[model samples]
Target: MRIAIVDYGMGNLHSVTKAFEHVAGDDASIVLTDDPIEVAAADKVVFPGQGAMPDCMRHLEESGLKGAVLDAARQKPFLGICVGAQLLFDYSEEGDTPGLGVFAGEVVRFPKERMHDEAGHKLKVPHMGWNEMFIAREHPLWQGISQGERFYFVHSYHFKPSDDIAVIESAYPYRFAAAVAKDNIFAIQCHPEKSHNAGLQLLRNFVHWDGRP
Candidate 1:
Protein backbone atom coordinates (compact mmCIF):
# COMPACT_ATOMS: atom_id res chain seq x y z
CA MET A 1 0.00 0.00 0.00
CA ARG A 2 1.14 3.51 -0.70
CA ILE A 3 0.74 6.03 2.15
CA ALA A 4 1.31 9.67 1.48
CA ILE A 5 2.45 11.99 4.25
CA VAL A 6 1.69 15.34 2.64
CA ASP A 7 4.41 17.99 2.89
CA TYR A 8 2.68 21.33 2.63
CA GLY A 9 5.68 23.23 4.06
CA MET A 10 4.21 23.61 7.59
CA GLY A 11 4.15 20.44 9.73
CA ASN A 12 6.62 18.45 11.78
CA LEU A 13 6.98 16.25 8.74
CA HIS A 14 10.13 14.38 9.69
CA SER A 15 8.86 13.04 12.99
CA VAL A 16 5.41 12.16 11.68
CA THR A 17 6.97 10.47 8.67
CA LYS A 18 9.36 8.56 10.97
CA ALA A 19 6.55 7.45 13.28
CA PHE A 20 4.53 6.13 10.36
CA GLU A 21 7.63 4.42 9.08
CA HIS A 22 8.13 2.70 12.44
CA VAL A 23 4.54 1.54 12.58
CA ALA A 24 4.09 0.65 8.89
CA GLY A 25 7.49 -1.03 8.43
CA ASP A 26 7.75 -2.89 5.11
CA ASP A 27 4.02 -3.38 4.69
CA ALA A 28 3.33 0.02 3.13
CA SER A 29 5.23 2.62 1.18
CA ILE A 30 5.39 5.93 3.08
CA VAL A 31 6.24 8.94 0.99
CA LEU A 32 6.47 12.57 2.17
CA THR A 33 5.86 14.68 -0.87
CA ASP A 34 4.70 18.18 -1.82
CA ASP A 35 3.52 16.94 -5.19
CA PRO A 36 -0.25 16.89 -5.60
CA ILE A 37 -0.16 13.93 -7.97
CA GLU A 38 1.65 11.78 -5.42
CA VAL A 39 -0.93 12.73 -2.79
CA ALA A 40 -3.76 11.94 -5.19
CA ALA A 41 -2.36 8.55 -6.17
CA ALA A 42 -1.71 7.31 -2.63
CA ASP A 43 -4.00 4.71 -1.13
CA LYS A 44 -4.04 6.58 2.17
CA VAL A 45 -2.98 10.01 3.31
CA VAL A 46 -1.51 11.47 6.48
CA PHE A 47 -1.96 15.23 6.59
CA PRO A 48 -0.12 16.87 9.50
CA GLY A 49 0.43 20.53 10.31
CA GLN A 50 1.59 22.95 12.97
CA GLY A 51 2.05 26.75 13.45
CA ALA A 52 -0.71 29.25 12.59
CA MET A 53 -3.89 28.35 10.69
CA PRO A 54 -3.45 31.09 8.11
CA ASP A 55 0.04 29.90 7.36
CA CYS A 56 -1.04 26.26 7.03
CA MET A 57 -3.81 27.25 4.62
CA ARG A 58 -1.47 29.47 2.69
CA HIS A 59 1.16 26.76 2.32
CA LEU A 60 -1.39 24.15 1.35
CA GLU A 61 -2.72 26.29 -1.50
CA GLU A 62 0.65 27.75 -2.41
CA SER A 63 2.21 24.29 -2.58
CA GLY A 64 -0.55 23.35 -5.02
CA LEU A 65 -1.66 20.28 -3.01
CA LYS A 66 -5.03 21.53 -1.74
CA GLY A 67 -7.11 19.73 -4.38
CA ALA A 68 -5.22 16.48 -3.95
CA VAL A 69 -5.48 16.67 -0.17
CA LEU A 70 -9.21 17.25 -0.37
CA ASP A 71 -9.63 14.37 -2.81
CA ALA A 72 -7.61 12.02 -0.65
CA ALA A 73 -9.59 12.98 2.43
CA ARG A 74 -12.84 12.22 0.68
CA GLN A 75 -11.69 9.11 -1.20
CA LYS A 76 -9.27 7.30 1.09
CA PRO A 77 -8.39 6.44 4.68
CA PHE A 78 -7.16 9.89 5.56
CA LEU A 79 -5.62 11.06 8.84
CA GLY A 80 -5.26 14.70 9.81
CA ILE A 81 -3.19 15.97 12.72
CA CYS A 82 -3.21 19.17 14.85
CA VAL A 83 -3.67 22.18 12.62
CA GLY A 84 -4.39 19.64 9.96
CA ALA A 85 -7.51 18.76 11.91
CA GLN A 86 -8.59 22.36 12.23
CA LEU A 87 -8.23 22.89 8.49
CA LEU A 88 -10.83 20.20 7.78
CA PHE A 89 -13.51 22.54 9.02
CA ASP A 90 -15.23 25.20 6.92
CA TYR A 91 -13.78 28.16 8.81
CA SER A 92 -11.48 29.13 11.65
CA GLU A 93 -11.43 32.03 14.09
CA GLU A 94 -7.69 32.22 13.61
CA GLY A 95 -6.91 34.98 11.12
CA ASP A 96 -10.54 34.62 10.09
CA THR A 97 -9.37 32.05 7.57
CA PRO A 98 -11.44 29.64 5.52
CA GLY A 99 -10.70 25.92 5.14
CA LEU A 100 -11.41 22.98 2.83
CA GLY A 101 -15.06 22.74 4.02
CA VAL A 102 -14.89 18.94 4.02
CA PHE A 103 -16.48 19.08 7.44
CA ALA A 104 -19.10 21.50 8.63
CA GLY A 105 -17.72 23.31 11.68
CA GLU A 106 -15.91 26.32 12.99
CA VAL A 107 -12.53 26.21 14.67
CA VAL A 108 -12.40 28.37 17.76
CA ARG A 109 -9.78 29.25 20.30
CA PHE A 110 -9.92 28.16 23.91
CA PRO A 111 -11.67 30.87 25.90
CA LYS A 112 -9.16 32.95 27.77
CA GLU A 113 -11.45 33.42 30.77
CA ARG A 114 -11.77 29.64 31.17
CA MET A 115 -8.09 28.99 30.86
CA HIS A 116 -7.74 28.67 34.59
CA ASP A 117 -7.88 25.25 36.23
CA GLU A 118 -9.93 24.40 39.33
CA ALA A 119 -7.10 25.65 41.52
CA GLY A 120 -7.15 29.00 39.65
CA HIS A 121 -3.78 28.50 38.02
CA LYS A 122 -3.72 29.99 34.55
CA LEU A 123 -3.08 27.48 31.82
CA LYS A 124 -1.09 28.30 28.73
CA VAL A 125 -2.74 29.39 25.51
CA PRO A 126 -1.18 26.67 23.38
CA HIS A 127 -2.42 23.99 25.82
CA MET A 128 0.80 22.13 25.25
CA GLY A 129 1.88 18.75 26.71
CA TRP A 130 0.04 15.52 27.49
CA ASN A 131 -3.64 15.21 28.32
CA GLU A 132 -6.16 12.41 28.71
CA MET A 133 -8.79 11.87 26.02
CA PHE A 134 -12.26 10.43 26.52
CA ILE A 135 -13.44 8.15 23.72
CA ALA A 136 -16.79 9.69 22.96
CA ARG A 137 -17.52 7.28 20.11
CA GLU A 138 -16.08 4.15 18.59
CA HIS A 139 -14.02 4.01 15.41
CA PRO A 140 -11.56 1.63 13.74
CA LEU A 141 -8.69 4.04 14.33
CA TRP A 142 -9.34 3.78 18.07
CA GLN A 143 -9.10 -0.02 18.15
CA GLY A 144 -7.24 -1.48 21.13
CA ILE A 145 -7.00 1.89 22.80
CA SER A 146 -8.66 2.38 26.13
CA GLN A 147 -10.50 5.43 27.39
CA GLY A 148 -8.64 8.30 29.09
CA GLU A 149 -5.47 7.65 27.08
CA ARG A 150 -2.97 10.48 27.32
CA PHE A 151 -2.05 12.05 23.99
CA TYR A 152 0.45 14.79 23.34
CA PHE A 153 -1.21 18.05 22.28
CA VAL A 154 0.04 21.46 21.20
CA HIS A 155 -2.63 23.77 19.95
CA SER A 156 -4.70 26.81 20.83
CA TYR A 157 -7.65 26.17 18.55
CA HIS A 158 -10.01 23.16 18.37
CA PHE A 159 -12.65 21.77 16.02
CA LYS A 160 -16.33 22.11 16.92
CA PRO A 161 -18.25 20.03 14.42
CA SER A 162 -21.77 21.12 13.48
CA ASP A 163 -22.93 17.57 14.10
CA ASP A 164 -22.09 14.79 16.58
CA ILE A 165 -19.10 13.45 14.68
CA ALA A 166 -16.65 14.14 17.50
CA VAL A 167 -15.27 10.75 18.46
CA ILE A 168 -12.76 11.99 20.97
CA GLU A 169 -13.15 14.74 23.57
CA SER A 170 -10.83 16.49 25.98
CA ALA A 171 -10.66 19.59 28.14
CA TYR A 172 -8.38 22.48 29.00
CA PRO A 173 -10.82 23.50 31.73
CA TYR A 174 -13.58 23.14 29.10
CA ARG A 175 -14.69 20.24 26.96
CA PHE A 176 -13.99 20.38 23.23
CA ALA A 177 -13.56 18.06 20.31
CA ALA A 178 -10.18 16.40 20.37
CA ALA A 179 -10.90 14.23 17.36
CA VAL A 180 -13.63 13.70 14.81
CA ALA A 181 -14.49 10.94 12.32
CA LYS A 182 -16.67 10.83 9.25
CA ASP A 183 -16.67 8.12 6.63
CA ASN A 184 -13.04 7.65 5.53
CA ILE A 185 -11.68 10.71 7.32
CA PHE A 186 -10.28 10.72 10.85
CA ALA A 187 -8.68 13.80 12.30
CA ILE A 188 -7.22 14.57 15.73
CA GLN A 189 -6.07 17.61 17.67
CA CYS A 190 -3.32 15.68 19.41
CA HIS A 191 -0.02 14.56 17.93
CA PRO A 192 -0.36 10.79 18.00
CA GLU A 193 3.13 10.33 16.65
CA LYS A 194 4.43 11.78 19.93
CA SER A 195 1.97 9.95 22.22
CA HIS A 196 4.20 6.92 22.83
CA ASN A 197 2.74 3.38 22.96
CA ALA A 198 -0.93 4.35 22.88
CA GLY A 199 -0.29 6.63 19.93
CA LEU A 200 1.62 3.93 18.11
CA GLN A 201 -1.31 1.56 18.59
CA LEU A 202 -3.66 4.11 16.97
CA LEU A 203 -1.33 4.53 14.01
CA ARG A 204 -1.01 0.75 13.75
CA ASN A 205 -4.77 0.46 13.68
CA PHE A 206 -4.92 3.10 10.94
CA VAL A 207 -2.46 1.16 8.83
CA HIS A 208 -4.88 -1.78 8.77
CA TRP A 209 -8.19 0.05 8.86
CA ASP A 210 -10.42 -0.30 5.78
CA GLY A 211 -11.85 3.20 6.37
CA ARG A 212 -14.84 1.71 8.15
CA PRO A 213 -16.03 3.17 11.44
Candidate 2:
Protein backbone atom coordinates (compact mmCIF):
# COMPACT_ATOMS: atom_id res chain seq x y z
CA MET A 1 0.00 0.00 0.00
CA ARG A 2 1.14 3.58 -0.63
CA ILE A 3 1.19 5.13 2.82
CA ALA A 4 1.69 8.87 3.04
CA ILE A 5 3.26 10.18 6.21
CA VAL A 6 2.15 13.78 6.64
CA ASP A 7 5.08 16.08 7.37
CA TYR A 8 3.84 19.34 8.83
CA GLY A 9 7.37 20.13 10.08
CA MET A 10 6.45 18.54 13.42
CA GLY A 11 6.10 14.75 13.02
CA ASN A 12 8.38 11.92 14.06
CA LEU A 13 8.46 11.19 10.35
CA HIS A 14 11.61 9.15 9.88
CA SER A 15 11.10 6.57 12.60
CA VAL A 16 7.46 5.98 11.69
CA THR A 17 8.49 5.45 8.06
CA LYS A 18 11.02 2.88 9.19
CA ALA A 19 8.44 1.07 11.30
CA PHE A 20 6.16 0.82 8.27
CA GLU A 21 9.08 -0.53 6.33
CA HIS A 22 9.66 -3.23 8.91
CA VAL A 23 6.02 -4.35 8.95
CA ALA A 24 5.13 -3.83 5.29
CA GLY A 25 8.35 -5.28 3.87
CA ASP A 26 10.47 -3.72 1.06
CA ASP A 27 7.59 -3.46 -1.39
CA ALA A 28 5.85 -1.02 0.94
CA SER A 29 6.37 2.57 -0.15
CA ILE A 30 6.47 5.27 2.50
CA VAL A 31 7.05 8.93 1.87
CA LEU A 32 7.35 12.03 4.01
CA THR A 33 5.39 14.89 2.50
CA ASP A 34 3.52 18.11 3.13
CA ASP A 35 1.89 18.14 -0.29
CA PRO A 36 -1.85 17.96 0.13
CA ILE A 37 -2.39 16.38 -3.26
CA GLU A 38 0.03 13.53 -2.57
CA VAL A 39 -1.43 13.02 0.87
CA ALA A 40 -5.01 12.92 -0.32
CA ALA A 41 -4.15 10.37 -3.01
CA ALA A 42 -2.51 7.91 -0.63
CA ASP A 43 -4.01 4.51 0.19
CA LYS A 44 -3.54 5.38 3.86
CA VAL A 45 -2.45 8.39 5.90
CA VAL A 46 -0.38 8.69 9.06
CA PHE A 47 -0.07 11.83 11.15
CA PRO A 48 2.96 11.57 13.45
CA GLY A 49 4.05 14.24 15.86
CA GLN A 50 5.96 15.20 19.01
CA GLY A 51 5.35 18.76 20.17
CA ALA A 52 2.86 21.15 21.72
CA MET A 53 -0.70 20.97 20.41
CA PRO A 54 -1.27 24.63 19.45
CA ASP A 55 1.99 24.88 17.54
CA CYS A 56 1.25 21.63 15.74
CA MET A 57 -2.22 22.87 14.76
CA ARG A 58 -0.76 26.16 13.52
CA HIS A 59 1.71 24.30 11.34
CA LEU A 60 -1.10 22.15 9.97
CA GLU A 61 -3.12 25.25 9.09
CA GLU A 62 -0.06 26.95 7.61
CA SER A 63 0.97 23.91 5.59
CA GLY A 64 -2.57 23.43 4.28
CA LEU A 65 -2.43 19.83 5.44
CA LYS A 66 -5.37 20.40 7.73
CA GLY A 67 -7.96 20.05 5.02
CA ALA A 68 -6.20 17.14 3.33
CA VAL A 69 -6.06 15.19 6.58
CA LEU A 70 -9.70 15.82 7.34
CA ASP A 71 -10.72 14.91 3.80
CA ALA A 72 -8.66 11.75 3.90
CA ALA A 73 -10.19 10.80 7.22
CA ARG A 74 -13.55 11.15 5.57
CA GLN A 75 -12.55 8.98 2.58
CA LYS A 76 -9.94 6.48 3.77
CA PRO A 77 -8.16 4.98 6.77
CA PHE A 78 -6.04 7.46 8.79
CA LEU A 79 -3.83 7.18 11.88
CA GLY A 80 -2.55 9.92 14.17
CA ILE A 81 0.17 9.71 16.81
CA CYS A 82 0.61 11.77 19.97
CA VAL A 83 -0.13 15.40 19.14
CA GLY A 84 -1.49 14.34 15.80
CA ALA A 85 -4.14 12.25 17.58
CA GLN A 86 -5.07 15.10 19.88
CA LEU A 87 -5.61 17.38 16.86
CA LEU A 88 -8.41 15.09 15.65
CA PHE A 89 -10.49 16.14 18.64
CA ASP A 90 -12.51 19.35 19.12
CA TYR A 91 -10.15 21.08 21.57
CA SER A 92 -7.40 20.48 24.07
CA GLU A 93 -6.78 22.09 27.45
CA GLU A 94 -3.11 21.68 26.61
CA GLY A 95 -3.08 25.13 25.03
CA ASP A 96 -6.76 26.13 25.22
CA THR A 97 -6.71 26.06 21.39
CA PRO A 98 -9.12 24.47 18.98
CA GLY A 99 -8.43 21.28 17.05
CA LEU A 100 -9.53 19.81 13.71
CA GLY A 101 -12.86 19.01 15.41
CA VAL A 102 -13.05 15.64 13.70
CA PHE A 103 -14.09 14.00 16.99
CA ALA A 104 -15.98 15.48 19.86
CA GLY A 105 -14.62 16.22 23.39
CA GLU A 106 -11.39 17.79 24.70
CA VAL A 107 -7.79 16.92 25.51
CA VAL A 108 -6.92 17.51 29.15
CA ARG A 109 -3.82 17.35 31.34
CA PHE A 110 -2.89 14.68 33.90
CA PRO A 111 -4.01 15.73 37.33
CA LYS A 112 -1.19 17.22 39.38
CA GLU A 113 -2.69 15.69 42.49
CA ARG A 114 -1.43 12.21 43.11
CA MET A 115 -3.57 9.30 44.25
CA HIS A 116 -1.29 6.98 46.16
CA ASP A 117 -2.43 4.52 48.78
CA GLU A 118 -2.30 0.74 48.94
CA ALA A 119 -1.80 -0.13 45.28
CA GLY A 120 1.51 1.61 44.60
CA HIS A 121 2.79 4.98 43.36
CA LYS A 122 0.55 7.64 41.85
CA LEU A 123 0.71 8.10 38.09
CA LYS A 124 2.19 11.34 36.88
CA VAL A 125 2.25 13.49 33.78
CA PRO A 126 4.12 12.64 30.59
CA HIS A 127 3.19 8.98 31.10
CA MET A 128 6.59 7.89 29.94
CA GLY A 129 8.25 4.48 29.46
CA TRP A 130 6.56 1.13 28.82
CA ASN A 131 2.95 0.83 29.96
CA GLU A 132 0.43 -1.97 29.71
CA MET A 133 -2.67 -1.68 27.54
CA PHE A 134 -5.86 -3.64 27.78
CA ILE A 135 -7.59 -4.09 24.47
CA ALA A 136 -11.12 -2.80 24.89
CA ARG A 137 -13.58 -5.11 23.12
CA GLU A 138 -12.46 -5.96 19.58
CA HIS A 139 -11.09 -3.57 17.00
CA PRO A 140 -9.46 -4.82 13.81
CA LEU A 141 -6.48 -2.53 14.41
CA TRP A 142 -5.59 -4.47 17.56
CA GLN A 143 -6.39 -7.93 16.29
CA GLY A 144 -3.32 -9.72 17.60
CA ILE A 145 -2.52 -7.87 20.79
CA SER A 146 -3.43 -9.91 23.84
CA GLN A 147 -4.31 -8.70 27.30
CA GLY A 148 -1.58 -6.93 29.31
CA GLU A 149 0.52 -5.93 26.34
CA ARG A 150 2.94 -3.06 26.82
CA PHE A 151 3.46 -0.18 24.38
CA TYR A 152 5.72 2.82 24.44
CA PHE A 153 4.00 6.03 25.48
CA VAL A 154 5.43 9.49 26.02
CA HIS A 155 2.92 12.25 26.52
CA SER A 156 1.47 14.67 29.05
CA TYR A 157 -1.92 15.40 27.49
CA HIS A 158 -4.58 12.81 26.61
CA PHE A 159 -7.66 12.52 24.39
CA LYS A 160 -10.99 11.60 25.99
CA PRO A 161 -13.07 10.63 23.00
CA SER A 162 -16.82 11.04 23.19
CA ASP A 163 -17.35 7.71 21.43
CA ASP A 164 -16.94 5.11 24.16
CA ILE A 165 -16.91 2.07 21.90
CA ALA A 166 -14.16 3.53 19.77
CA VAL A 167 -11.78 3.98 22.68
CA ILE A 168 -9.04 1.44 23.50
CA GLU A 169 -8.00 2.40 26.99
CA SER A 170 -4.64 2.02 28.77
CA ALA A 171 -3.60 2.97 32.25
CA TYR A 172 -1.71 5.80 33.91
CA PRO A 173 -3.17 7.50 37.03
CA TYR A 174 -6.47 6.34 35.60
CA ARG A 175 -7.63 4.68 32.40
CA PHE A 176 -7.37 7.02 29.40
CA ALA A 177 -7.94 6.30 25.77
CA ALA A 178 -4.71 4.90 24.43
CA ALA A 179 -6.09 4.60 20.94
CA VAL A 180 -9.28 5.62 19.18
CA ALA A 181 -11.13 4.69 16.03
CA LYS A 182 -14.16 6.20 14.35
CA ASP A 183 -15.32 4.84 11.04
CA ASN A 184 -12.37 5.54 8.74
CA ILE A 185 -10.27 7.41 11.27
CA PHE A 186 -7.89 5.80 13.80
CA ALA A 187 -5.54 7.41 16.30
CA ILE A 188 -3.01 6.35 18.93
CA GLN A 189 -1.54 8.22 21.86
CA CYS A 190 1.60 6.05 21.98
CA HIS A 191 4.28 5.63 19.35
CA PRO A 192 3.78 2.32 17.59
CA GLU A 193 7.24 2.62 16.09
CA LYS A 194 8.76 2.50 19.54
CA SER A 195 6.62 -0.37 20.88
CA HIS A 196 8.45 -3.30 19.30
CA ASN A 197 6.38 -6.38 18.29
CA ALA A 198 2.93 -5.32 19.42
CA GLY A 199 3.30 -1.87 17.98
CA LEU A 200 4.62 -3.13 14.63
CA GLN A 201 1.70 -5.49 14.40
CA LEU A 202 -0.68 -2.59 14.99
CA LEU A 203 0.88 -0.64 12.13
CA ARG A 204 0.75 -3.73 9.95
CA ASN A 205 -2.93 -4.17 10.70
CA PHE A 206 -3.62 -0.56 9.70
CA VAL A 207 -1.72 -1.09 6.46
CA HIS A 208 -3.82 -4.12 5.62
CA TRP A 209 -7.10 -2.72 6.94
CA ASP A 210 -9.73 -2.38 4.21
CA GLY A 211 -10.82 1.05 5.46
CA ARG A 212 -14.15 -0.39 6.50
CA PRO A 213 -14.57 2.15 9.34
Q: Per-model C-alpha lDDT, please? A: 0.92, 0.86
| Residue-wise C-alpha lDDT for candidate 2, range 1-213, written one tens digit per residue | 689999999967889988997888865588788899999889899988889998999999999988999998888888888899999999999889899888998888887876342487776567789988887767889889888899999888888877674557887767888888888888889999999999999999988888764
- Residue by residue across 1-213, what tens digits does model 1's lDDT show? 999999999989999999999999988999999999999889999999999999999999999999999889888999999999899999999999999999998999888787899999999988899999998998989988889989999988889899889999998988999999999999999999999999999899888888877
Error of 1 at 136 (Å): 0.4
- Pick out the ten consecutive residues of candidate 2 with the lowest summed lDDT: 115-124
Candidate 1 collision pairs: none
Best candidate, lDDT:
1
